[model samples]
Target: MSIKGQTEQQQAEAQLAVGYYTELFKPPLEPKKLPPPAKLPPVPQPVLAQRVPGAKEESVSGAWQIVADKLKEQILLRHYSPQTLKSYSIWMWKLSRFLENKSPETVTTSDVQRFLADLAVRQQVSASAQNQAFHALLFLFRYVFKRDLGDLRDTPRARFQLASFPFRD
Candidate 1:
């Protein structure tokens, strides 16, 4: 009621908080004291969603340069860094060529696995690079190519790594 009666913060808080609570439903449950939620770094969304549909289409002159080109365009239009466009384009180009200038629909899933294996064994690329190429190719099929890559039967199995058992000694 008077300036002497309460601190200004308390008075302001009281004024702001007035009539904020209801008396009609007081206590069937105790007020829950929840710990403040942990501050979490936002989960980065999957990058594959950036692929644009209707961009990839059949090539009139040859295999679809436009599909791979448009994917580059879409990537640029979305302002993705230049590095992503470079990496994706490299894989896209290789895959389209690997299909031997055929329509995407004409290609089978086995072709992809074969390509990867050949890239590893024949081309002598590292496993990580093969995996990167595989992911890039997958994004093309799932998003740009817009169809099931169809039971990729040649999935490389987990290779056995030789290790000596400690108990054997």
Candidate 2:
């Protein structure tokens, strides 16, 4: 091709390359709109009833239900895992039954001690289960009830058993 024709073709190619790079780096004309946060369904309140065998049917108070709801709220607000929430809820239900659904405000440290002892002695719960219960109660009192759980030094502890292997020398 002639020199002028070649020069025009080079200019066109350079413009095309510049256009491609500019489009590649250009910001989007409109920012993406994210969907609104989903609303969580309301949690159902657990019924407190005498679950022990041969225990007389009694109408316990619903005070513990309020505490459980508060515990759930605190756990959700802190962004804790769903499993942690479920564990805490189970422990709280057990505790409420042990306390005969007593109002959380009236619960004393001794009551907590007796409950822990009962788990160890009567229910024979595993060490990890007992520990989870302890932590759940601690969180309940600390956050939900806004009270300090006093010394439980004398509470009976659940024993941890080692897994034995028959082939071990």
Candidate 3:
């Protein structure tokens, strides 16, 4: 190849390398702050919401912070398992969203009952799951909310309880 051709090839390769590096280390695009009917995008960092451990206090929406604060106590006091923590957290999250961030004190038994009903009918979850979720939510209602639900047991999943079966010949 001629000198000019070789120089051009080297220049192209250098440009390609620079382009690849630029693409690799590119900064994340700023979220679009579009107008109405569009979301403003999440705040990115964990805002205060509440006085969390080792976290600065910043304004945040939702009841999660309060629920989370209570969660730590439950774990420390009752020694809930990690799975239970996650499950209970999920229940609280649903409840918060359902109530549209209403104060826990404002959550009525009817709200909880409706939520469970919706879970069974709309989500079609299994009996064990439904029961577990109910218990978790109940815990939040009774202990966290300091409220009563009064005999709002989940409708048992219908199943025949056969005492015994004949042995095969």
Off by over 4 Å in 3: 1-62, 153-169
lDDT of candidate 2 over 112-156, digit per residue (tens): 899999999999989998999999999998999899999999999
Q: What is the C-alpha lDDT profile of model 3 across 45-97, one tens digit per residue? A: 22224444422222223346766677646654786666676667767767666
Q: Give the range where candidate 1 is weakest over 10 consecutive residues by summed lDDT.
A: 40-49
- lDDT per residue (tens digit) for residues 47-93 in model 1: 33233344343242134556666666666566766666677777776
In model 1, state the lDDT of residue 21.
50
Top candidate on lDDT is 2
Q: Compared to the true structure, candidate 3 yields what TM-score?
A: 0.53
Q: After superposition, how far is residue 98 of candidate 2 from its true place, in Å?
A: 0.8
Q: Candidate 3 clash total?
A: 1
RMSD of each: 13.4, 5.6, 14.9
Q: Model 1, stretches more than 4 Å misplaced?
A: 1-62, 77-79, 157-169
Q: Please give each candidate's TM-score.
A: 0.50, 0.67, 0.53
RMSD of 2: 5.6
| Whole-model lDDT values for every prediction | 0.63, 0.80, 0.64
Ranking by TM-score: 2, 3, 1
